[model samples]
Target: MLSPGDTLSDFTLEGVDENGEINTFTLSELTDDAVAVLNVYVYDYSPVCTDQVCDISELEWLGINEDVNVVGISGDGPYSHQQFIEDNRIGYPLLCDTAEEIIEELGVLHEEKDGLRRVPQRSIFLIDSDRVVRWKWVAEDNWDEWDSGPIEALNDTISQIRA
Candidate 1:
């Protein structure tokens, strides 16, 4: 798993922007001028995932933090991400990892019991403008109840980094 201080390489992926348009975006583009919070979730509309994204989207500090870019990544496609953004009023861009390449590379890929399905393990990575990871949190177990503390911690970390 990627840890704090590891440098993340730039990668391109299709993402649904805040305006609900699908576009190709590279990691460098998102992090070049700002710190980035990479929120990796299991699925778009899954109950916990929905709550997770919504919590991040509604963070008050995020509205004022132009220097922090929060981007979500999941195996769902662009159409799903667009609907998710519209349905939940998500303010951040959600990238599609349909190929699972990024998820696997980040060591967050989760496989199902049946061995037929794979998804991203719920995780978050904070990367600074230099592409070095400053913080990382990965779920210990996939089915654990959702916790809002991590999101708050992420916000606090962003503030500390920019301070």
Candidate 2:
């Protein structure tokens, strides 16, 4: 339930590299001087989640946005994430949160229908250099429509921040 202007908590997350090696990173360490496009999904290989993240990867401007970094996050382990990345041909990093620490910290984890804790909803957060969430999107159900509006809003916010 974090909102715009809310400062993010300290989080040390593991992200896999191109070679599928695990790399540890912290939120405070990575947020400085950068804009992050964060996608928190329910599972690694789920259809809706994969489509959402892969579509994000297809955003042409992301590769050229030197000030921005695109990262997808899930509670899955690094191995599963590695496979997902390779299968999906994801060009960006897939953050590993096997224990769902970040998800629980962000208050997104909830009781799922399958008897396990799944990220309650698909949400996106646009965090600016200062580590404040500038844009956010939340969906209650998998069928919820979340288009590129968050990205557009993020671009607008980034422009304003630079101005």
Query: Highest TM-score, which number?
Result: 1
What RMSD does each model have against the real structure? 1.2, 2.1
Count of steric clashes across candidates, in order: 0, 0
Q: lDDT tens digits, residues 1-163, model 1?
A: 7788888888999999989999998888888889888999999889888888898898886789788888999999999999999999999999998999988888899787778988789999998888888988898866677889887788778878877
Runs in model 2 deviating more than 4 A are: 114-116, 143-146
What would the C-alpha RMSD of candidate 2 be, to one decimal place?
A: 2.1
TM-score (C-alpha, index-matched) for candidate 1: 0.95
Model 2 residue pairs with clashes: none
lDDT of 1: 0.88
lDDT of each: 0.88, 0.77
